[model samples]
Target: MRLNFSIKTKIILMNMGILIPIIIFIYVTITNNLYSNVIKSNIDLLTKESYNTQVYISNYIEKDKGVDIETNFVHKAPLINTYLSKKLNYRIQIYDKNGDIMTDSVANRVTLFDKDITNAIKGNKAYVVKKIDGNIYILFSSPIYLKDATLGCVRYIYTLDIEEKFINNMFIIMGILAFMSILISWLLSKLLSEKIVGPIKKLKTVSQKVTKGEYDNRIKIRSGDEIEDLAETFNVMSESIKDYVESLKEERQKQKKFLDNVTHEFKTPLTAIIGYSEIIPKLKKQSDIDESLVFVKEEGIRLLKLVEELLDLSKLGKSEFKIDRKKNNLKEIIEEVLIIINPRLKKYEIEIIKDLCDIEVLIDKDKIKQVILNVLDNAIKYSECTNINIKLQIENEKVILNIIDDGIGIAKENISRLFEPTYRVNNLNSINNNGNGLGLCICKEIMKKQNGDIKIKSNLQEGTSIEIIFEGN
Candidate 1:
C-alpha cells in the first residue's frame, strides 16, 4: 500500500527530529564535563607528589656534597614507593644526569611516549598520553635544577581506567534515556497532531460531501479558533451553493415549459397555413377559394411574426446586441405604432385618442417603435373598448408614455410576472389567443436596453394601464 504522509505523521517526525538531537547533546555534554573534572583532579594529585620529591632531593644535595647526595636521595625516594603507589595510584621514575634510569618505582612495564630524560635535562617540562600494552596512560616529566647545575628529572605515569569505565556506563544509561525520551516525544506529538489535524480532516470529508451535492453536511468543530472560523465560512458557502443550485433547477424547469409551449404555438399556425394552402388550391367556388387563401395568408403571417419575435428575444439576451441611439421625437414613434394599430382599431370600432407631446429623447428609432407597437398591440389584443387612450406626460426629468385601454384587464395576481419570458395570460378570451406570450417581455427588454423601464397596473374587468419611462436629456 502507498503510505500517505498525513499531517499527524509529519508533526510526529518533526518533533522527534528536534527532540532526539537535543537529548543526545545534553547527555554527551554532561558526561564529558564530569569525565574531564575527574581527569584534572587525578593529574593535580600526581603533580603535587612529584613536586615534593623534587624539593626533598634538591635540599638534600644542598646540605651534602652533590652527586653522592643525589644518588642516595634517588635510592631513598624509591623506599617510599609502596606508600606513594598505594595512596596516589601512580608510577614514579628518577633519572640521573647521564639520561640513565637509575631508580624506578614502577613494575617492569613502562608507559611513555619517548625517553623524557633528554628533554627534561634541556630545562623543559614534558608530558604526553600514550597507549602501553593496550592500556592508556599519561607520562609527565619535570627537571630538578640545583642552582645552575642539572640534578635529575622526575616522571609520573598514570592511567584513567577507572574514569573510562565510569563514563562508559554513563554512555549506556544516557542512550537508554535518550531513546525513552524520543519515544515519549513521538507519542506526545501524536496526541497533539490528533487535536490539531482532526478537525481539518472532518472539514475535508464534509467538503467532499458538499462537492457531491449533499450540501447539508457541515463541519461542526468546537475548537474556538481559526479552525472554527474556517468551518463557519465553509457552512455559509455550502448554503449559498445550495440556494444557487435550487434557483438554477427552477430556471431550468421554466425554460423547459417555455420550449413546450413555443413548440405548440408554432406548430398550430404552421399546420393551419399548410392545411389552408392545400384547400385553397383544391376549392372550385370563388368565395371558398378566397376565404381559404385569406386564412392561409393570415396564418403564414402569424408564423412569421412568432419567428421574428423569438429571434428578437434571443438577440436581446446576448451581450453583443448593440443599439444606435439618435435624437428623436417620442411622438413620431407613437405615431408609427398608432398607424400599425389603425386597421385593428377601425375593425373593432375602437377609437384612438392621443394626448401626446413633442418630447425629444435619445433613442433607437426602430427598436423603440417595436416596443411601442408591442405594448399597443397587447392593449388592442387583450381588451375591448370604444376608445384607447394614448397619453404622454413628463414628470421628474422622465418622459412617461401611458397606454390605457378599457378592456378585460389582468387579475392582480398575474400582473406581477407579466413580463417574464414566454409567460402568457391563461384566461384570455378566444379572440386574443393568437399571442406567442413573449411580446410584453420583449417590450420590457427593449425599454431596458434604451435605459428606460416599463410598469403596468390593472384590475379584473376594469382596464389595464402601462407606463413606458425614458430619461429626459
Candidate 2:
C-alpha cells in the first residue's frame, strides 16, 4: 500500500524536519542559559549591594569605640536596624562571632542560628537556601572589621520569587516568538512552492497537448531562467512539428497525384483496345472489303493515338516531360484541335460551334493540346446529342475554355468526384462505351501542373459544361 500525502502536508513536514529541531535547540538554549545568566546577574548585583551595606554598618559600629557594650550596642543596633530596614526592604540579621544572630531588622529581636547564615559566616560569602516555609532566599554575610580584625557578621536575606517571575515571563515571550516564527516560515514555504510548481503544472498540461498532436500549442513562460529557456525550446519544437506536418501533406498530395495520373494513362490505352476489339467483329461481317479495310485502318489509327497519349502521360507522370514554354496563339491551337477531332465529329454527327476570342498564353503547347483533346473526346463519347459547343474567352488576364455538350449530363452527387481517377459518372447509356473514367482526372492533373484549374457544371438528362481556366501572360 502507498501512503498519500498532500502537497501542503509534505511541505510542512519538510519544514518541520529542518526547522523544528533548530527551534527546539534555540528555545532550550534561551530558557536555560539566558534565564540563568539574567538571574545570576541580578543576584550578583543584589549580593554585592547587601555586602556593601553590611560593611558600612559594621564599620560604623566598630568605629564607635564605646565602653558600655550592652546599653550602647542595644541603642545603636535598633537605630541601625531602623535605618537599614527603611532603605533596603530585605531582612537583615546581625550575627556574633560565635555564629549566633544578635539582631534582626524585621522584629528588632535576637535572630535564630540558621544553617545558611552559619555557612555564610564560615565562608564570608553568599549562601542560598530553600526554607521549609516554601520560600527561596539568598543569604549574604560580611564580617564586621575592627582595626583589621573580624568582630561579627552582618547577614542579608533576599527572596527569589521576583527572579522566578522574570524567568517565567522570559519563557512566555520565547514561546510566543517561536509560534510566530513557525507561522511565518510556513507561509513563506507555501508561497515559494506555488511560485515554483505553478509553471511546472502549466508545462505538464502543454506537454500533454503536444502529445495529442496539438503542435501549435506553446508554453509562454517569462521567468528569464532555465524555465524560460525550456519554453523557447518548446516553441521551436512546435514550429519543427508544424513544418514536418506540412512536408508530409505535400508528400501525400504528390503521391496521390502520381497514382491518379498513372491510372488515367493506363485506362486510355485499355479503352482504345476494347473499342477496336468491339468494332472488329462488325467489320468482319461486312461484305465490302474496301469499307472493311477502311474501318480496320480507322481502328488501328485510334489504337495508335491511344498508345501515344499513354506514353506522353507516363513521361509527364515521371516528371520527365521537359517543357520549352513560350507565348502561343490560343486561336490557332483551337483550330488545330478542330482539325484533329474532325473525324470523330463526322462519325458522331456532332456539329462544332466555336466562339473563340483573341487570347495568348504561355504554356507547354503539346500538354495543353492533350488536355483539350481528352476533355473533347469525353464529351463526344458521353454526349449522345449532335451539337458540341467550344468557347474561348479572356477574363481577368486568364484564358477560359468552356466545352458544352448536350449529353445525358453528370449527376450532381458525382460532379465532385469526376476528377478522381477511375470514378465514372453512373450513366447507363454510355456505361459500355465510357472509355476509361480517367480523361477528366488527367485533364485536372495537367491543369494543376500548369497552375490552372477546371470547373464543371451539369444537370442530369440536360447537358454538361466544363470550364478550363489558365493564367494568361
For candidate 1, the lDDT comes to 0.74
Name the 10 consecutive residues with the lowest summed lDDT in model 1: 260-269
TM-score for every candidate vs. truth? 0.38, 0.37
* Candidate 1 structure quality by residue, lDDT tens digits, 172-272: 99889888888888888888787779887898789889989999887889899888999999999999999999999997897776665555335445544
* lDDT by candidate, in order shown: 0.74, 0.70
RMSD values, in order shown: 36.0, 42.9
Cα lDDT of candidate 2 equals 0.70
Clashing pairs in 1: none
Q: For model 1, how big is the CA root-mean-square deviation?
A: 36.0
